[model samples]
Target: MIRVVVVDDQAVVRAGFRTILESEPDIQVVGEAADGADAVSVARRCRPDVVLMDVRMPRVDGITATARLAGPAVVDPLTVLVVTTFDLDQYVFAALRSGASGFMLKDVEPEELVTAVRVVAAGEGLVAPGAMRRLIVEFARVGWPRATGPLPDLTARERETWLLVTRGLSNVEIAAELMVSPSTVKTHVGNLLAKLGCRDRVQAVVLAYERGVVRPGLP
Candidate 1:
């Protein structure tokens, strides 16, 4: 079973998520927290496979809580799916930067929420709803402030791979786009991650935008 912890300031929201997740045989809600402080405590104690976290909370915000539990700074991190009401561009970028495994809106359908938990539990990351537009807007606005040549370090193939990733293409899609195999794309992605010092594709996407290596609103 995929152990999960539900963290939100609203009692109803927590209860609602718990109900939706507990209905699934593959998922179990191990604990619940009304604030970030308790969320951290529950995470450490339950060691859940997926944490449904809220962005705004008392004591500590979701960004800080996510950083503490799943941030790149953590030696071993938990998978945090930031469930927020806001689709604010800043929140989307900040959550990814803080190392959240996924982001979703609070109003996401129950089915999507379940899939998101499984995706993160399987060690894959998913960007939140409307993430692409937000990503592009944020990057386009911020990336050129310190513009330079196509990331000087990336190889031709690596740059291609990075472009596909930043465009929100899946590994399979990238393989098809470049007429390569999925494993080949995966290798390129891995190398790009190492070369770029990125923890995951989310960061790669962010960097690709922030560096103008990829443009916003481009497919």
Candidate 2:
């Protein structure tokens, strides 16, 4: 079972997520929090696989909470999925920089929410491709994680995998595109992420954008 903690200020929202998530046999909503401070406390105690967070709470908010749970300074970072009613880029950028594993709009369908949690749990994230690319590019300009300077050496196949990832292809799609197995693509993805000093695929995409290896709206 994939353990999850849902954090939101509204009781109804929390309850609704729990209902939707628990309906899936693979998912189990283990806990809930009403605000960021409590979210930190509860998550620390539960140590769930995924923390579904909400921004703009009364105390601390999701950005700060995400940092507390998964920031670079953290010894053992937890996976965080920042789900917000607001679709503003600022919140998305802040959350991602602070170590969120994935992001989603609260208005997304229940099935999408479930899939988001599963995707993050299975180790791929950043919601849909188009919006994720836009957010990473905008954040790249701000240069929070600093994807500048010389990129480490990468194998030709790894480089190919990286570009396809920047284009928002999943491992399965990349496998088919390259005529390679999915596990091979997974290894390539992992090797490339380590080489790029990226914490995740989202940051790797940002690095490519910052380095001008890829540009906006090019197919």
Candidate 3:
């Protein structure tokens, strides 16, 4: 079963998510929290596979909660999916930077919500291509600091794979572009992630932009 912890300030929202998620035989809501501070406690106690987090909770916000639970500093991080009513690019970027595996609008369809949970649980990112592009553009507009120091040593093929990922290409699309098997593209992607020390593709893409491997306003 996919264990999930629902965290939101609104009682109604939490109940609604539980109802929708429990309707799936494969998913179980192990706990719920009314705010970010309580969310950390509940999640640690329950050790859920996925956390459905709200962005604007009182006390600690979802972005800070995500960093505590899933950030690079954590020894064994949990996967967090930021679900918020707002679609602001800043929130999306902040969530991803905080080590969230996915971000979804609160109005997401039931089917898509279920799939997103499954996807994040399987250790994959859930940001769509368009959202990712907007995130990058927003990061650039705000003049985010570029990555400092030497870049990780990646092979030519791995670098190519990373660029393709920043371009929002899936493994299948990358395979076709590189004229290689999909499995090969997957391998390259894995190597890229490992070398960059990224938790998921969203982080990888963010790192790529920060390191200037993929610049903004490019074709």
Best by TM-score: 3
Residues 80-172 of candidate 2 have per-residue lDDT tens digits of: 998876566778767877888878888889998999899888776665665666665665565444356787889999889988988778889
In angstroms, how far off is 20's CA in candidate 1?
Answer: 2.2
Please state the error at residue 46 of candidate 3 in Å.
0.3
Which candidate, 2 or 3, would have the higher lDDT against the true structure? 3
Clashing pairs in 1: none
Clashes of each: 0, 0, 0
| Cα deviation of 9, candidate 3, in Å | 1.7
Poorly placed runs, candidate 2 (over 4 Å): 133-147, 217-219
In model 3, which regions exceed 4 Å deviation? none
For each candidate in the order shown, give its overall lDDT on alpha carbons. 0.82, 0.84, 0.86
Any idea what lDDT model 1 has? 0.82
Model 1 CA deviation exceeding 4 Å by range? 138-153, 215-219
Across 19-112, the per-residue lDDT of candidate 3 in tens digits comes to 9999999999999998889999999999999999999988999999999999888998999999877556787678788889887788878887
Q: What are the candidates' C-alpha RMSDs? A: 2.9, 2.7, 1.9
